[model samples]
Target chain A: MSTDDVDAWVESARRGDRTAFTKLFRAHRSLITAVVFRMLGPTGDLEDVVQEVFIQIHKSLPDFRGQAKFTTWAHRVAVNVVLMHRRRARSRPVLVEEEAGGHEPDAGLLPDQDLSRQRRVRAFYRLLDKLSDKKRAVFVLHELEGMAPADIATEVDCPVLTVRTRLFYARRELAQMMHDEPALAGLLAELELAAEGQEQAADADEPARTALGQGRDRRSDP
Target chain B: MTERESHDNIELRPSSEFSARAVRHVVAEVVAAPPPELDWARLETRLLERLESERVTLRSTPPGSLGALFGFVAMAASVVLFVLGAGGPAATRAAATDQLVDVATLPVIDDALGAHSHLAASLAPGSALESGGAARRFVLPGVAAFMLAPGSRVVVRRTGEPYVLELAFGQVTAEVVPRHDTDAIVEAFIVESGGTRVAVHGTVFSVARSPERVEVEVTEGVVAVGPAGYRGDTTGHLLAAPSRATFAARDARLIEVYAPTRATMAAAATPRRDPASLLPAANPLGISRLAEPDAEREVHVRAASRQAPSAPGRDVRAEAVPQPLQGNPGTDATSPPAAGGEPSAAGAVAMSVADARAAMVSCLRRATANAPAASLSVSVSSQITVTLDGDDDVATVQFAPPLRPEIQGQCAGLLFGRAVAGAGSSFVIPFSSR
Candidate 1:
């Protein structure tokens, strides 16, 4: 949506227009839920946090200056809320349940393929949990969201070099963790073959070939 | 082989699909998870309910009649007369020079003063005042007027010196009347928060004490702010109007001064009804007491003022009275229709770039109407790449050149899991704030 559209709704909401505010909430709810979910994982109180975020947004809407996009400002609020949640959780002790045993492979897939992928994914999150907040945020933005270091830097309010350094460390740690797990090792082998197959497929398509070349060029840069 | 050797032997290409799969899993488990179904109607009802409650709280009347006002004024007059009549000439002189500030307006909260419910009493040195639920306004006649935010605790330090307000917690906004003469009676007013001290003579500012830092925002005049002990020393920074500074709780010496954003100035300028006007007219003896229950009196006064003939000078006051939000409360179906024709079950008709840009701009403008015009002046150009799911809902939103840190979170939050009106597809559109 255009900035003007967002601004008008903000104005309407500020004026106590419930419909406008609801529109704003509906428009941004998914994004906030996703970010919060990614940052804090699928906790039971996810909806509560989302509600708090919207309430805060409503309270603070009057002060929003449009210095940045509405979404950007809301994102900052979500991040701060996540950090605060972490802080509060740290102050008090809570019981954490151990992970349930691995799921059995469905009828279609090979037992190793299904179990290994699930295990690798679980192990990935575990490794991510070990990283510091800044590093994890940088890594998630860059690797998961397909954002560049500079973009991650902008989002996290850090220098590009810092983002790159954090991503590097996050990747190194995750790689080490994966190397230690035999299932993850097998998953890696499968992913490498899949990527190679896709690369060959892309070579046959002219646009994809160009995009792949451009991607290579970007990665090759300092 | 050593652990380092094994690590070196392993191929760890950062961009390999293994990393991709891990990221995909994380996304699937978190970002792509089905959000809990929100009962929008119920949520809206609850929100409106909360808003109504706040409005009522903010507009309620104090529990007393005009008789209470008269009785309070009579009692205060009797006390003054007793003091003057009983005091000898020398004692009367000392009493006249006493620098006690009066409570201009009692907060609406039930527990404003803890055990002491009455704010009709003057605030003396060494006296501490605490407020809950509602903000209390105190006036040092001709010196300053300060409103303490809810849940704030402030202490009036010893007299015969620069008036010192020790803030233990919460926020306070002070409007210090300028002293024209160099030898004014009140030499200075200082707000002490944590280890940071803000010294002022004539200024409108706010000081908020948070867990990690003390934030000072100056709106009108200059102030000297620094470590609490550096009273006359040059250890602190001089902050001018339209600026803010934060002092860390752990380190007094470290102060971060930031240029005031549009939001800062707007917050500092939030209109407050004059507490004196909310009270009944001053008594014949010129003593004004807190009589009105809540802000309802202010609203009545506003309604009365609106009925008066529109004198040329009254325009400013009319502008000052905040307008209630426009729109009927019951209407819920106000979402604007999509510009293009309705989407078929198979797929939405692709929106032309120009049409899409116009639609987006209109939406954004509506969303940010209340934002400061100056901050909105800069044209923001963005390229939004939207990936749609099979149902035509938005699965992802990516901005080119990346969004600013402040905007990214909101964009991600609102765009990631939304369903747009179209079949599964990926498209990029450029939008500009003009």
Candidate 2:
């Protein structure tokens, strides 16, 4: 788990040592799977896509200048591969059932609670698919992965303003999409509660102001 | 996870905070789920094989060189020895062994298989097949042939108990071959993954496995999914084709979700409890059956699970699709279906009555395409009232008049497949073919 060992493996893997590459693959396998799953949704072929990312990493390892942490670079690779995979799947926009590993069964959740949670997630992903890949990447990295806007900007090689803009637009689009799905009653209820709570807080001081505080639409100029 | 006031996305509008928190809340299961060991094992094996294959490719000697000549000679020697051994005593031993012998080298009795149902590609033993983009068919020989969906990886093991294909990941539909004496001997083959060996029951079914869950969907007949060497009828779950069984696992604990379709609607009909009435409360339709994966009691449980408080009445998958209700196996249209509980769910993705009728007409068109070109007038005069009772997500009609029993079944299959919300809904369409 030490960075020095990982760096050594990267050094040897760069020299075409299969053992070193295997070690690298073992270390980063889970990280890559999580990245692909979050970026591409559960329907994405995790194993195949992850295998592809590693292969790409193996091929590109020599050029890896050790500038960024290996995990960050791997994340970038996963995002690129997932976007490419989505491009090829343009004809079939239908989402398949969430793969077995998409989520672990939560023993803590009652059967009904688990089902409700799953349906809500499925609804969210269906809406998430509507956004373009760039918007999806930034939004997923920021929202789902809980990365900071600055870190996301660095990961995607874009500006913080661009990342923020994509996150805002993606959220707006998802809210619009979720509005259409009544099955998203659970999530919608939460959204309403949050919006209502915020409105109440804002209205307490500014009694005349009634409109909800809209997040600033940070649209970057083309 | 920050408080609403300090939420990163929700600086002011709660919508941003809602989106982030909402999605995270729902996906907490996935975010925290660890990769199943069986899945990791399969992936690791494949990765090692692939890396080794590529390594050989990278290090192979240049063509026409002495080293290349030696490599060619070695390959040729192995092929010759294999052919000889396959033809010699190995062939004799293969015939005598009860499925334990290597069948890859032996000739498959294709004549014994159903006509037009043979494998697309006759695979050699230990051949690893990957469906890159299109579905590929692999003959399980004496038992059946399975169509591997695109992006699936399977390895055909032909050693001992050779009638097995290890599905590393992805979906594969196996259509069990018809046999005159099929009833006498069990039509069993194994699709092994995740330390589970699913024995094929009679008919067509698909088993889709991921690291943490395995889904068995029956489209034709029933399939038996249980431990290795388990009798499907006696010990295993006889998952009918019209149903889907999802076994989801968290560490050692397992969660099961069984969603029965309209194909089994009559068997799964509920008392007239209105779903719209239940919609305002906790999602009654959003329910799953939690059970220990290894518990085996009786067949009555499977039948009984089709009804009552935990009715296998509605499918949770309908919400995953955002488009109109499209074609499923029985539901022939490319549509999205909202979860079929409330009218709102159906209204979200339910295809129109007009669209459904059009699809029905198309089915008639295909059936009647080869009918004499001369105009033959056939009018369906009776009002086929597709009724959806309360909890009965299934739609049934009181076949008004001269409708054949087969046609009633077919039409029922169509409507039941469209078990959208709104029980007291009514719609009518007229079509005449001359």
Candidate 3:
């Protein structure tokens, strides 16, 4: 939605128009829900967190200076709420199921391709579980979300160097884990070979080379 | 062979598709999982209910209001009459005293008055009553009754032929029956608090008295509220039901009218509940479902593309084309320069790109010093665009992708303080971690 539309709805909602507020809720519910779900993972309190985000948005609307897009501001609020939930959860005991233990292959089937795929998927999440919340968020945004280190820095409110460092560590750790596991070793080698081929191909493509050079310049250390 | 053919010829291992398959799996399992069904209408109703409750909680009541003091006093006088032998047993007291209005049993009163379940409360012309920290209810048979809020003191007085109540503090809700007496003379019921008086014929209203003002809220009938002697004329305001009038003690000339909301009345009538206990519990298994691919998800897929060696140069266009900058919502085309001064040419700013970077490094180092290292990741390179005024003082520093407020504040403090050579120029300083 345009800024003007948001501003109008906000003004109306503040004046006690429930319909206008509902409109605002409808407009941004998806984005807020997605962020909350991603940050908390599938296990935590997704619905409560989303509701809390809206409640907070209503309370904080008066102070909103329109400094950022409504979605961006809402996204930040969701992130903060999730972080707080994480902190509170740490002080309390939580019952979490093992990531890989839940799914059993069909009873009569042999160890087939689908089972192998499911195993790999489970292993991926296991690796993700090893990182701290901050590193995990950074990795998810960069590697999974395809956000640049710079954009991830802005979203997570950290320095670009920090984002890069987390990404570097996350990738290194995942690679090590994959290599250590016999089932994942062959897949890891195959990915590594593809990566090598891609890098080599980048050297041959003129535009790719220029883009790579620019990427390097922008990525230079302070 | 064509490029596509050669690419197709390259042996595709099971693991070659591992990352793609894993991405799809995670997306399907978590990101794309369906959210629990929510009834928006029900949620909205609950939210509105809570908001109404909060509004009533925040509604301002006149301080030192007569409601509190009068209620207490009325209750106290009842106790005093019962203790003294002015009235016999509680049952007989109702018929004995001509001056006594009525006697009724109180279901709930302050713990102090717990022993006296039967309240033989009656106010004579000269009698005064005080209630402390407990609500008192009095039913005047065939005439009028009132519920006195806690901490009230009230004295009954005869101003001419009218029955006038002098409320010193706190609040009271009185329901007076209209005068239908066929007798020769009829007297008006007047509630006097602060410098204001509310005259009622037959109505249900609440009067609150504070040191600063007297407020009257009419719930069921009409009331004339104004300075004590202003006879229902230009000086007095006629208040209908569901309306309120406030008379300031400082300036008798000012009277404020208010329309009380239905929620406010309902809340006042209903007992207050602890707010925290009402919050709904979180649903642990309800992950949000994705209906369609979002911008962020697309970014995720594109990032995955770069990792696949088999898709070398498949579409480098996605990475090469910079996403359009999401401008600061606060900034506009007509916005003033960042330095809060006249816009200056970029060349006019004296600070070199290097100087700004150094400043940013210093600021960021300080800001992140106490923060956990793991929490300090910035995925994208941050571009801090500093605009300097004519005097070379930093006018404004805008972060391309906004950083946390603390970090932004730190950067602003460091860069704006220094005098640059070309004061008006804008310098884009990029901070990259790697």
Candidate 4:
């Protein structure tokens, strides 16, 4: 959900409106899951992370200053929660990603057909997976999400220089991986062009996408 | 990337050859849509549990709002007024001078003396009575003779041959003489501001009473502490033997306790028949027992002031149906219906046993009185007689077999434990498997 919408719902939820809080959760559930799942991974228990994020928001909501957007703060909280879970599980790691099971979706692995647009998109994500957790996070936030390098560094609690270095390394690694694999590289190029075209289309549909993003931002705030 | 490009599937476009190549390779290896729809029921339950626990902790030590502090201060002031009393102007003036640092207002009282304004101190033959501030010491000639503190009262119904103190009060302690046969017994009590009273029999126990709560410690004997109520309530619940306690105003509970000594148990066991089996129906709250012959012995037990029916002589006898033993051998005797109709059958059995044991112990004394040199061990058996209240019909009678004195001692401990655990009076008697 957007900051304004979240701020509105938060004010109502604090007043004891249960429906407002549920509406908030339902609208933002997908965004929360995406953020949590990124840091936690498919096998990572994101429920705990999501719950912690909301609970922390609820507990600390009374202290919110409205200086920053609720979505920004929520993203920060989601990252912290997933990091904490990772730290706790590091000793006895139990990664249960769908890749290890028959339940794996068709979108996961590379297809052997003459590459389709969707297939190329899937291939690009496959390349992104090769980067380390920290580097991948920086790439997604900086290059993909276009978040400011300074803000990404602050969110990850790292030096801005480190965020830039990680992003640089991630991009270099992706370029090299694509170049080394000829067949995959051709598909990757097509996918990148298609993505650029979609961006144009999405900008044309900005008002609609903005509405969906705003709705999501609101629910995930608190 | 521009905002337009970033918001769209920028990496998935076919026009950007370099970005497309990278995106394809990334996508080829990227796992399926991440499993984001996690089962949250377990997390929700855990959060609820934590919420409940947090609430309880918060409630136990709630932050006092303005009115709450006022209530606390008011309650505290009232207690101080009641304890100091209107008559003690000098005490009140002195209290004002030391209001902040007065030992009386200390958050927690250390021992029996700190908790009570009135205290009973019984010194054995050689023990010295220490005079403290504001305390009026009562010196009894021997262990048998007892003293009552100011604002405290006790009734001594009878004195055993060896001399034992029968104590009932807000606070009292007796020094035990190893050579003597009796220990101090304190009964139904009310500590000025404290809600509970602890009664100890056949031991050296000290009690401290405060307005909101009472604390008791048995330095060397057995004690029973219960809640002696206020206004119209009298069924004071006992606060059982707590090794040490920091009681608050709402502390009224029944606790039964026994000091199990191998030597004492051996001595008690040597005696034939269970002393508890001989408990007297007349004194249901009896704590001490002695050998008595087939003669009259003075026994003291508490009944509601209303339960003591009027009679021409000390010996008042009334009859009712004796409760069936069921599986218990002597339970019927313990639970005989009172002479005047009252639902005290449950408590009566233990009281009756205490009385009968004391009576039987007196019988042994009588048996030895004729032959001073003979120290023959004696066991007493009692029978419960149930009488038809209205008519002169001969009701059924049940014989309660005797038990060894030591077994009675164990029963005393077991009973006290159960009573304390159940927070009730009357020995919550426990039985052995055998």
Candidate 5:
């Protein structure tokens, strides 16, 4: 659907049109679920929180003045729901619940690959829980959600400089935590090796690309 | 994919340093999980049903005559109670300040708690059901969790207000949910023992109380211990996490504290001292047990003292006495170091555990400021056991659950090799963000 169609559907949904509301829900469901999943980390309450987000969106739909994009509004709604969910429960959930597996889509993930990925993800979240809420939100939006600092500042309602500063400190804190966590030793070693391998690959490819750019011959003088 | 917002693959990028390379990988894995494939039709149905039900409830419960009458009657009763009771703000504050406490830490919670009439029976564990209290754990769900010792008894009272649990005798470790300043139940949960009441917010702490004295040790968060009814958020000495304070149970006077740099921090900014930091008062690392005759007392504290005398007139210098650890137990608790061939602590300066802790805190604060990429804004918990060798007064720091071998070197660099006090005594300091 084009922008016009979305805007029309939003208008109808604002006016309580069931079909229009359903269409909008289906349209934004993926974005909403992805955000809620990442923000809440692999806890199993993604469904309820998503439902709460839609409900909240429906309730506050009239107040949304189209100042931001529909997805941005939906993202903010999801963030707010996650915040409320944590505040109400005050429970620090770990990935033990996900250890049984089968929750993530297994389309292409190999068995060993899946387990290591899960372990790394779990460790990251456990450390992530230590961050204060404000810093955590800003970090997630920028680092995980792939948002630019300026965009994050707009989303989190903070100054751009503030967002950049938070991101800088958040990265540093996370790096130190990764080093300090004893359980992640083996994983940390693997990551460093992988980094070294990637750097070597890039180094090998760089000369060939440079030679091509300069129209140089392949054979050396020797 | 949208205008102005680019969902770039920033998370998959490598960090700037080798030590932190794991952060990029873990974060990448976390966000890599595909958006779940849910039965969209079913999910939408459930969501619509919930919304409809809420709407119906709101429509059905439109305030009517009966609701108005109930509200009026409750308001009138509240007004009468307010006027009839002490017609002062002090009384009102007292009512609002009523605290909620976990009885699991109370020793006399069994049958001898009657003399203390304020001990609300409602919170007495297994009281009404008369269920045998055979060492059961009482959980306050999300708020707090307590482990009952072998012979101890406890009852959970889940109320919305704050409380005071008078600790006649007992030892208990509790991890409480972090509370905010804006909570509806704004009053702090108080644990009252002999002569002091320890008020705490969100923190993990352990309290041990005897008829004669009480000791409160905080492993996380800040706590305030003052006389039984000291109302000073400002005046009460603050004890930051990983420190312990001993008070006379009857007199409730603060005898000694093993807190790090609290006095210096508070002295520097007495008015502006973050109530969140340890209190401004000097923490003279003192454990009443240090004076006991027990040969197995293991007192672990963060090392590094500024050499500032913790307390006036209490210049308890480090005697050449060997307070050897349990493995190498010294004969007399106070006997001179010449009692045996064990390495005498003669040359070791008397250093308190707080000295090293202060040094670490100061060093870390600088480390964060100096290293742009090494700053710490979040709380990180790492416990280090430093043994005062007295040989060179150079303490050996051991990090439990150990850091990466290379990074361990970095942690030591943060300490700057400052001399640790409390010669011959092992001190375990749990470090965190100030």
Candidate 6:
């Protein structure tokens, strides 16, 4: 885990030492899998992406430079591999259940309805689905992952201004979804409550609060 | 009571804030270590063999420079054939002719129209008839749809439009848009496995059969699949939506729909055996036994949870899970092996989860294998509930026809799988059925 040990492993891995390469793969398998899963969706082929990432890491390791952190470089490599792999995936857009025409029928509701909180979150994602793929990436990285805008700009190869603009718009869109979709707004509130609960449990994890506090700084950019 | 009211509540709420938590969970899972003992030895051997054979060329010492000149002349002769698109004169024409045939076959489905019934035919727009099963690739491009009885397998070139497949008992993979849109053309693509009939609408999908399960995946648009009604449950459920995937158990239950990410896709080359969440909820329509007449039993019937309550009149009995086969045996529940005996908890869970997983895996594998032209249709008879162990999230769907089962199930699986594929064990628990 030390920097020195990490440096040696990188050098060894670049030389095609299977053992060294295996060590590196072991260290990052889960991280790579998570990234790939987020980029794709949770469902089928988690293992496929994991194996592919290792294979790609092996194939592309020779180009690694010490300029960036090993994790950063690996992420860069992983991003490309995921995007390419995504292309190879059948370009099918999973559809939502088509709404049946006419007034919403009053079907039976579950007797124990604890779904008040859950339904809202579902609507939020349904709205998030409307954002363009690029905007979505920016939003997910900056807001969800809490990656600094600069880091996102670097990863996505765009200007920081563009990242900021995307974030601004993304928030606006999310906010608008709140206004336009009452169900979504309630869900957002529930989400905030859930997040607050988690925060009270682990004060360390609520980066969103800090991110929110920095709203002034973001606004000052314009 | 109304979607509008649902919207009203959502508007008053805060934004969904599990992003960071979800991401962190994903990070922890992704960064975990691989198991100590994998078939590394075999993988290494394979890699070495490939390197030795492909990277290292055999070098021979010619008898002086004169022999070298002769070698160059022989090399030129070989080069001419390759450069001319063939290794030899006959090979060149054959290759060209095959290309021509493939090109002529441009759209695979058009030819399938009016083709003889019960007879498997090539649908590839322009591919040549090489020989044997290789020729089966052509069947995908031509047919609009076809029917299959138990024990049938068909291969077709990838296409676009969904083809209807009737599965009495067997497996078939149709081509989707493979590297090109023109690759998919055909209409009726049918594979009937265990009385379930799946029709490909406008998506690229595939289906595989085992004795107990039938797997389906939508590589492109969503595919609609339902039970062909061989026995136990006649109603079929939509497996997956566009880009989503699902598997169908022979008991005729549709398992979770999963969306493959880049990583999982890369990791899995063959059908996966990982345990999956349960299928879509069973349809409550026309239940022979129920506690109430309008119990909305369809919604609960397909519920994935073991605790999912059963219909009123139908006696809900707890049964043990069935013993898992050595690996996944794609069995549809209704094909001959009647449910006369009691299943152990281990057996029931294994069967439920395995069958569901197989349906999804088979769907995906077949899509990659066969891209058929024509629109795929999906109709579900009930609601579906997906619950994950160790995770608070449970995806529940109570909606109408053309259900996007793939997306629903995939999201549920991914959400849970991301957090629990390794350390935390999970299974799709089916409720006790009468």
> What RMSD, rounded to one decimal, does every model reach?
25.8, 21.3, 28.7, 29.6, 18.3, 24.9
Candidate 4 local lDDT, residue B214: 37
Tens-digit per-residue lDDT, A26-84, candidate 2: 89887888777766665536667677788778878887888999888887787777765
Whose TM-score is higher: candidate 3's or candidate 5's? 5
Model 5, span B1-434: residue lDDT tens? 64223423234222556645566667667777785676677789987776664443233222321111000000000000000000112211111222435444333322121211122334542121111243233333323333333333222222434433322112223333344334222333333322345554333344454334455554333444444322223113334333455555533455555332222222212222222222112221122222322111212222323223234444335432222222231332221122122311221234345655654555444443433245544444456656443432433344443322222222332222223444454566676653
Worst 10 residues of 2 chain B by lDDT: B76-85
Model 3 lDDT per residue over A134-195, tens place: 78788666544445667778877899878777766665566555655554665556666887
Candidate 4: residue B289 lDDT (0-100):
26
* C-alpha lDDT values of all predictions: 0.46, 0.46, 0.45, 0.36, 0.46, 0.37
Q: Model 5: residues >4 Å from true position, as ranges?
A: A1-5, A89-102, A154-157, A180-184, A194-222, B1-16, B39-42, B61-434
- True lDDT of residue A133, candidate 4: 67
TM-score of model number 4: 0.31
Docking verdict class for candidate 2? incorrect
Return the TM-score for candidate 3, rounded to 2 decimals: 0.33
Off by over 4 Å in 1: A1-6, A66-69, A87-91, A97-123, A145-147, A179-186, A189-222, B1-434
lDDT string, candidate 2, B1-434, tens digits: 65321445454233655555655565564455443222666676677776664454333212222111100000000000000000111112111112222223434333322222224345545555555575444454444455545555555544333345544344444444444342332434445443234433333333443335555443333343443311222123333333455443111111342334332332222222321121112221111211223212212333333322221555432332233333342242223221232111122133345555565555444433443345765444443444443433333333333233223333333443343433334444343443
Per-prediction DockQ: 0.06, 0.06, 0.03, 0.05, 0.19, 0.03
Weakest 10 consecutive residues, lDDT, candidate 5 chain B?
B74-83
Q: List TM-score per model, in order.
A: 0.35, 0.40, 0.33, 0.31, 0.40, 0.33
Candidate 3 has an fnat equal to: 0.04
- Better model by TM-score: candidate 1 vs candidate 6: 1
The CAPRI category of model 5 is incorrect
lDDT of 4 by residue, B315-427 (tens): 22233222232223223323322111222212322223334333324433333234224575333333222111111211111112212222222222222211111112112
lDDT of 4 by residue, A155-195 (tens): 78899779777866776677666655555667555666798
- Please identify model 4 stretches exceeding 4 Å from their true place: A1-8, A12-20, A87-91, A95-133, A143-145, A177-222, B1-20, B24-434
Model 5 accuracy (lDDT, Cα) = 0.46
lDDT of 1 by residue, B310-404 (tens): 45464322232221112221121111112122211111122333333344445444443454475666556666665554544343344454333
